[model samples]
Target: MTSTDAFNTQGNATAVTDPHTGETRYNRVPQVTWDFWLVKLLAVTVGETAADLINTSLGLGLTNTSLLMSVFLIVALVFQFAQKRYVPVYYWTTVVLVSVVGTLITDNFIDNLGWSFTPVTLSFTAALAATFAVWYMVEKTLSIHSIYTFRREAFYWLAILFTFALGTSAGDQLAEGLGVGFLMSGLMYAAVIAVIAGLFYGGLMNGILAFWLAYIITRPMGASFGDYLSQPVANGGLGLGTIVTSLIFFAAIGATVWYMTRSKDGLEVAQD
Candidate 1:
């Protein structure tokens, strides 16, 4: 079932509730919606372009950039976890930082260690599967709607990190390793997401399954889209350069988060 379905099934009287105690709880994450997904795509795209800008254009190198972004991610997470409930600005900022860190982690594995994309992709896939397995074993549910506890939030973030890493490796594998160009790769991933959405809306697929599937695909889609915008024309892109690409996506993400903050449109909260 989808998270909304699960929530309704448990109790339709509230925005959130403890299944065991029937006490109201608040989610620390935003509700999944069109806007949420849009911002997420922007965040991942910025992750790709911003990482390239910092590592190459700014001459920080992959290792240095990774180190710096890692520190930033830790600080972002500190503020994110400190909040008792969802705050759009804090939540999206943490997501953006996580996206950058995830890209750097994958880049380091490939460029610095000379690891093949196949192994890197496989390893991250295994890690994500393991995380889900453990999370389900402990929580008995993987519904995003149930992410009202610290432990669940931790598992949620870990899954997100792995998804970003896996997406980076898989995107690179398809575009660079397998010789597909960025635009084509982006189109391919977008097509897959469309199919998944069709299945979900058609009632042929489980909601949680569809949500996670679309989530995973968006990473590669965003990566390919970013590369297409930022790379040179000879490389089958728009030749926008990393700076321009990053700035565009960063502005998009910031605007979306600001809207969410002002409207509280996607904020997760309990209903009375």
Candidate 2:
């Protein structure tokens, strides 16, 4: 999940604990693995459906739902970042909250502010680029493996929020603005992601680049699939309803997180 091997959850050195403080310190994020990708996809899918459920199905509207989810995200992240190492419950909870809020951000931008998809997409892209630029300038590395400090973790979360928002807007634009069906849009993004993976595995791409690229691409792909399944048949979806779709994804995420916790498969120890 860093500039190092993408699948290297544990580093060369063993974990360290501060004897004086009796606290363990390790990477704040999880290891990049198949389950990691699985949870990410599930989270993004739930993100799409959860936003629709709260805004349209529950009649909370975009603004209120955004405010409510934003609050929940802040609280969840407060708990997550407080940990010195990866904690599945806290970290995944934050991720799910972030995904929902990211969907809301895009929705509020286009629906409430009446901004066009092109502009919204461009804005989120620029914002993400700026965050990465500043992060690299300060830390000299954008490695996910180096997220052992507050500043790097801040940059990580900020960039993640932008990715979700960007993915949501761009996916909507392709799936609706251009009259591309949601299922096809999902397939298109998935195909592109597959190409990226092929390039990475073929040793033509940097690990960090491959990881982040896949991470970003999965957003649109998962969102598109979520919409296709949750929307009405008249609207090109399978008519499962947002509630059913959300429940399905959340259950999968729960099971995956439980596995990660039990196996300790996604954590890396931080050196002293």
Candidate 3:
């Protein structure tokens, strides 16, 4: 190439561009450790309780609540994608928003559209599996620790979105549809998670396997907990109202995120 052409290309590279300008532009994932899972569980719980609170307690109803929350999620996701690196606050905010969106997506399918939980659950599961298949094909890995590129980040969020959707459907099926109620369903999933944890700590299972299993189970567990608090007393819940439950969880999430930001506990090298 000519010297002038080379100089022009270098100038373009040095010019200020977008919101992502620093080292944070490159890393897309936080290290997968105990804190990661803990915060994740909190986010899912908040997602369930917060969504229910808005829809019921605030008298927004499912349809309106979904619309409002969906819009917020879109905004949050836009900001999240604009970031070049992993900011704990921004990342977790996106997670919490997506959790609510995921819940609404399933709720719309089952409640508004009059679809059955069985079909919805299976459909979302298939979709998530297909996402993983394609993501693995394109990225050659599904491990969260290695999510450093744009493509991997895309796959990561897509998978998370499906997990929330599938979890909502499954949780609803086992609780209300099957007449299992909220408490029992929560306990059941909690027990299963405990077993997975034991296996992982005992070295009888793989870390990634345990992580993914727990990740999937945490959704139903959180959903059941949310239902137990927000559902009416006649429905075997505390009648606390969805708004109260959601507020409580949202506050908790906010505090946790604040602590994480100051502590920088979950932000580090994600390499295994």
Candidate 4:
């Protein structure tokens, strides 16, 4: 049977037929919009600051913090998958946890294993590319609009994790390892993302390509901004401290999620 036939047979909660591909999908992820990008950026920023807070300020150490956060991430993913539908709270919660865990994973390689930044970034990039290759080969599409099946969702989260790790490593390499400073690095990423957006709006790029490009760039951009706000003045930051930065972004994310939960405008709808 066809994809549409399979979706119809499954009787999903919100199946709709894709006009372009003639495929039916359940719309298990949120629609890509301004709000979606805003919350995502906040979540990554919190991820960087919060990881530093727990590992350094709280004195948990990198190993201990990674262990603790990894456990929580697993638990969050369990609840997320259990929902079998896009729940704003659970979905964003998972994203936040994954972001933190991804940062910690990269940190472990550098601090514990003594791996350098370039190798870590390259490794994660390769991993993410492989994931996309396999996902496309298996599911025939990498568009977020088709994230209706459990397998697709699994691939989606895995790719997200790699993006976070890759972003962390690349951002740190440029900002700290290369001495570009956090603010400058953030500006660089922002410019690149802006160019990508311009291309999309000008009808020179595909929507899926634009979406993934922005998605990957946002990770480092958020991390750079987070470090700039939270690090000490000696370290080129604003000296706001991790506690304040994390709390501010947490509130922002919470407010956005609350609005998304109440508004159909933020919810995912299958393409007609």
Candidate 5:
């Protein structure tokens, strides 16, 4: 039931029926394009900040925060897995939930469990590498363009979880441990992402490599940006507060997803 299979089955179905009727199937993945990244960035950014808002702004604490977000992630993932075709609401909900839950995983390990950021960061990096290793071994390909089966979706979500944890730890190390300010940390990560993009666009790097590198880097970059806007001015932030930042980002994401759904503008259905 991987995205790849879902797409093939749905694409081949002539007259698909809804779930209640047990009719036909439909394609999954939207067409890969610039819009995909735009929405992705928005979703990830919300994930970065929303988690903080729930855990800190609402005073839920790490334990409660993780538990709540984990529940939401599980529910969102269920809907995502149930769908035969790509649905923006389900897809983005899962993404946002994963982002929050992933951040909490890293936070729990680092803050609640007394693990150092260095070890947490390295561990998540290794985990991501291992996931990729296994994914490549089984699938022989890591391209997002062909995610038509459930197995690929499993691999994809596992990799995503690692990215969020890695990003959280890395961002914390840079901003708090290394004494780098929020804005500076964001700029630093942004520069690195820019280099990856340049290498990819200039033909110096492969598409998958560039994509993964950028994907990993965006976590810290977005986290840094989130902290910069949400933290108090005394802490070198604009002091917008997590509530305002989270609300604004969520609204923007909702509007964007709504538009994308209606227009099918960012549809990335796999094709021959």
Candidate 6:
């Protein structure tokens, strides 16, 4: 914590001493933690309900909802990227906005643009692949822990946008297009995520790949479950309503973020 400490900032990405070794590392993102996953799930669950609330209940429709949420997401991302290091409020706020916009993007492709499930899914998959390919080519690493530079952060967010879009498309394909229903779709994705977790813990897969896979799948899983809880029984759901579901999850997100902000859950040192 001395002025002579090798603290540094790489183009707005803050770097801090490694504590034990005093090595500098740019860690702009939060560490992978339980609360991280918790908030992420809650945020995505809110994404589904919030989208429904705006599109159906509020009568904004798909196109208008998409446009509005996209604008909000851009604003949130502006604040997120402005931070030199990880800040829980800005980071999770951006995530919630991204989740909403990602869902809307896919919904627009289908509901508004008249695209089918197969094309939408495939397009997002291809886009996500290209993003990762270019990111790896330039950065030579795809580890979240190494998101110390602006380009890497940019790549990270772009990849996430694709994941959410891909997940929405695939989830709809499974839940509605294939007549699987939302509850079943959520269960299927949950089973797949469980297998991925097992593989990662067993060392059959590396952390980076496993993390991204789970990240991609969780989007659909959360969305599907959210729909199941919020939609009416006529629509194969519990009829809890979108407002109730959104309120529940957003409350959870607010509490988690408050705790994270007060305690600094992921960061070890007081910097950034």
lDDT of 5 by residue, 127-227 (tens): 99999999989987776655657898789889988988888888788778768798998899889978876776676877667777777788888778887
Which ten-residue region of model 3 has the weakest summed lDDT? 3-12
lDDT of 2 at 140: 81
Off by over 4 Å in 5: 1-27
Residue 167 CA displacement from its true place in model 2, Å: 0.8
Q: How much is the lDDT of residue 147 in candidate 6? A: 70
Model 4, 135-190: lDDT tens digits are 99998777776676689889999999998998889878877766788898889999
Off by over 4 Å in 4: 1-25
Q: Assess the local accuracy of residue 58 in candidate 3 as a C-alpha lDDT between 0 and 100.
A: 74
Per-candidate alpha-carbon RMSD to the true structure: 3.4, 2.8, 10.0, 6.4, 5.7, 6.4
lDDT of 1 at 104: 94
Off by over 4 Å in 2: 1-24
Candidate lDDT scores, in order, read 0.85, 0.85, 0.76, 0.84, 0.77, 0.82
| Higher-scoring candidate on lDDT, 2 or 3 | 2
Greater TM-score among 2 and 6 belongs to: 2
TM-score of each: 0.91, 0.91, 0.84, 0.89, 0.87, 0.88
For candidate 1, the lDDT comes to: 0.85
lDDT of 6 by residue, 1-272 (tens): 21111111111224457678876654667777778878888888898899989999999888889889999999998998887677899999999999999999998888889999999999999999999999989987676656766788999999989998998888777777667888888899899988987886676876667778888888989998898999999999999999999999999999999998998875533232
Determine which window of 10 residues in candidate 6 has minimal summed lDDT: 2-11
For residues 1-272, write the lDDT of model 2, one tens digit per residue. 44245533233445657678968768898877777888999999999899889988999888999999999999999998899888988999999899999989988888889999999999999999999999999988786766888998999999999989998888778767667888988899999888887887787876667777777888889998998999999999999999999999999999999998998877876642
Decreasing TM-score order of the candidates: 2, 1, 4, 6, 5, 3
Cα lDDT for residue 117, model 2?
A: 95
Question: Residue 8 error for model 5, in Å?
Answer: 20
| Prediction 3 TM-score vs. true | 0.84
Model 6, which residues run further than 4 Å from truth?
1-26, 268-272
